[model samples]
Every structure is written in C-alpha cells, then in structure tokens.
Target: MLYRMVTPEHICPFGLKSLDLLHRQGFDVEDHQFKSRAETDAFMASEHVDTTPQIFIAGNRVGGYDDLRRYFHQPVADPNATSYQPVVAVFATALAMALAGTWATTGTLISVRSGEWFVAFSMCILAILKLQNLETFSNMFLGYDLFAQRVVRYAYVYPFGEAVSGVLMIAGGLFKWIAIPIALFIGGIGAISVFKAVYIDRRELKCACVGGSSKVPLGFVSLTENLMMVGMATWMAVR
Candidate 1:
C-alpha cells in the first residue's frame, strides 16, 4: 500500500516511483491518494508523519521516498556531490542550437559560420544563466575574477555585456564593430583571471562561467569559455 498526494496543481513524483517499484518487484499496489492539501495535512496528522509518499509492505510501514529507496537498496542522490552535468548540458544544448540555426540559415550543418554561431549561442545561454541570479553570479565572480575584484561593479555589468555582444554577433555585419570589441575586452579579462586563479595561484575553486551556483571547476572548461570568446572576436576582426 502507498499513500501519496495527487492534487490538481501538483502530482507527487515519488508516489509514481513507489507504484513503479511495487510493479517491478511483482507486488500488487494498493495506491491511496490525498487529492487536496487539506486531506494531505489531515492524513499526515492522523499518521503522525511529517512527509507523504508513505509506503507500506505486508502491513509494515516503509516511511517516505528515501526510506523506500533504502529498503530496496537504491543509491540516493547526494546534494553535495560535485557534478559536471549542468555545464555539459549547457554546452551540448548550445552546440545543438547553433548547428540547427546554421542549417536553417545556410542549409548546412557544417560551415565556417557554424563555429561562430556556436560561440555566440554559448555566450547568450551562459549570460542568461548568470542573469537568472545576478547577485549570486556577482558573488561568485568576485571570488576569482581580477577585474571584478578591482572594479566590483564590473561583476554586475559582465552578464549584460556578454548578452549584448552575443546578440550583436548573431546579427553580424555592422554589429561586428560593436560586438568584437566587447567580446575581446571581457573575454581577455576573464581568461586572465581564470588563468591566474587556477593555474598560477594553484587555487581550486568553482567556476562562475556557467553561473554563481554552478559546480563547474575553475579550470580548463572556464578558461576554454573565455578563450572561445576572444577567438571569436579575433576571427571576426580579421575577416
């Protein structure tokens, strides 16, 4: 037996998981749902439990989702574990978007423009990530960015600059004049900061490249992002 919340606005994911687990293990499930907040709270009070998605097997209470996972010997996610998944997802999506955009515009997946589009898309996506929580990004940036540390206000300005330059780069032609310099300046500063903090100073830190709350390492990936910006600006300038 499983009791879980299933309201009009929200369905409990763990409840679904519990049902699936019972089915997978060949145990027939008697699922009980609390359809509203009032019913859920009343049920919790009656049961003397603080959380829902409670599981019962053979009349024995198995507690909540995590408790059920432990009963089945499933590894639970550790919140503090460092993972590259977020940054990897960001880069992969940016590359895919750039390729799709290139194909739509020039009818080719592979082109000289593909690389340009990729970098611009990455900049736009990363800027949006930072802008999602500017205060957090600013705090993270101050940890290692030399320019941001000295100027302070530059930390707040960085995301907007990157966003504007990225949009302008995508527009091309006349916008290159504006975009190139902006990308070059910020990228140059970022590259130097990452290099000094990680390689020169030998400090192990989290990167602010993806966002303030990102667990991305303050090393190669961060440096690569800055270098890509500088390279894109230089490429556009020479062309």
Candidate 2:
C-alpha cells in the first residue's frame, strides 16, 4: 500500500491509525511524507482524491481513513448506532466497587441500604468519567440539556454537581442537607430535558451520561440517570 503522510501543521491522526491497522493486517506499506502543502495538493489533484492519508492496494485507490476501514471490513463511524456498551460497562464496574466497598466496611454486600450504596457509587463513577473529559462532556451535554442550551455553563457544572452528590450520598447520607437537594434538582432537570428532546421534540441524539465521548443513546439510559437521582433523593429524604 502507498500512503502520503502529512506535515506537523496538517497532522492526520487517523492516518497513523490506518497505517497501524494495515501493519497489523500483514500488509507491507510504502509510506511517503509530503514535504509541503503544495506537494500534497498536487498529489491529491493527480490522484483525484479529496483527503489523506489515502491508501492504494495493488493499484486500487482505497480512499481516505474511513474508506480504508471500509476496505478492511471494519466498523467506521456510524452516528446513528446507539451504543450502550460504555454506560453498561461503567455501571457494572461501579456496582462491583459498591459491593466491594460495602463488604469491606460492613462485611456484607446485602443490607437494608445496600441499594443506596450501589446507586451512590454508580453516580460517582459516571461523574468521574464525565470529569475526565469535561470539555467533551459539556459539548455532548449541550445537545439535549435544556439548561445547557440556555446558560451553556450548566453543561460544565453538571458533572461536578453529580460527583459531589454521589460522594455525599456514599457517606451514609450524612450530608443529606446538601446531597438530597442537588440530586433532586439535577435529576429533575435532566429528566425533563430528556423527555422534551427525545419524546416531545423527537430528535435522535447521543447521551452524555458516561461523558461526551460515549455513544450511549439519549433515551432510556439518560432518563434512568435522572430517575435514579430523583429516587435516591426521595429515599434520602424519607429516611
């Protein structure tokens, strides 16, 4: 395969990824680096291709990064594909940690309030994921979050609020004064925004529950996050 690599100014990340993919697939690649933008443009014009880094397999043009992926029968980008894998994995890990945490502290996983521990830990774990890429999370959140649409800053604050509430809840509801209110308030807004966007507005979108990079769909799991908060807050209030 022949590949024309770019300069530092026009770095193509997927070019590297595609090259690696080709290497793993046991294809001997002859890669060339374009010294200048003019050279690169000339190469593109000569080949009649729009983007790079392109691959040519046995004199057949394989197009750009995505086209290479397709030629290799690999899954490229599909925005419509609703992915629950990230959210499911995060929740599963959080549940395991909650069980381990409770067992470590109480010497038992099953208790009267074990559910609380699970929910608290789940929120904390999800919030931590969002906090990992706050900018990405906020950008994804702006898609469906009503407050984020209006205020914009709320998208950035949402993760912090979730993290605080989850941590407070994990402390055996000691800070019910603060935790309960945050849970209810955020959850309420989240649920309403999701309902309006997914049901009323009927738009297809990704959920920012696991963070902006996640592919979790904006419907069931999104609503569940909000409902979980409301439920946790209500339980805290009653108890």
Candidate number of the best lDDT? 1
lDDT of 1 by residue, 1-239 (tens): 99999999989999998888878888989989989999999999998999899999999999988888889999877776777888888889989988999999999998988888889899999999999999999999999999989999999999999999998888774578889999999999999999999989999899888889987878998899899999999999999
- TM per model? 0.88, 0.72
**Best-fitting candidate, scored by TM-score:** 1
Give the alpha-carbon lDDT of every model. Answer: 0.90, 0.87
What is the clash tally of candidate 2? 0
With a 3 Å backbone cut-off (N, CA, C), the pairs that clash in candidate 2 are none
| lDDT of model 1 at position 87 | 83
Which digits, one per residue and each the tens of the lDDT, describe model 2 over residues 1-239?
Answer: 65665786876787788788889989999887786788888888998888778888898888888888888899897875767888888789878887888788899997756788888888998899899999999989999888889999999899999999999998987879999999999999999999999999999888999988877789989899899999999999998
| Predicted structure 2, TM vs. truth | 0.72
Tell me the spans in candidate 1 whose CA falls farther than 4 Å from its real position: 8-10, 24-26, 35-48
Model 1 RMSD, rounded to 1 decimal: 2.3
Q: What is the C-alpha RMSD of each candidate to the true structure, in Å?
A: 2.3, 4.1
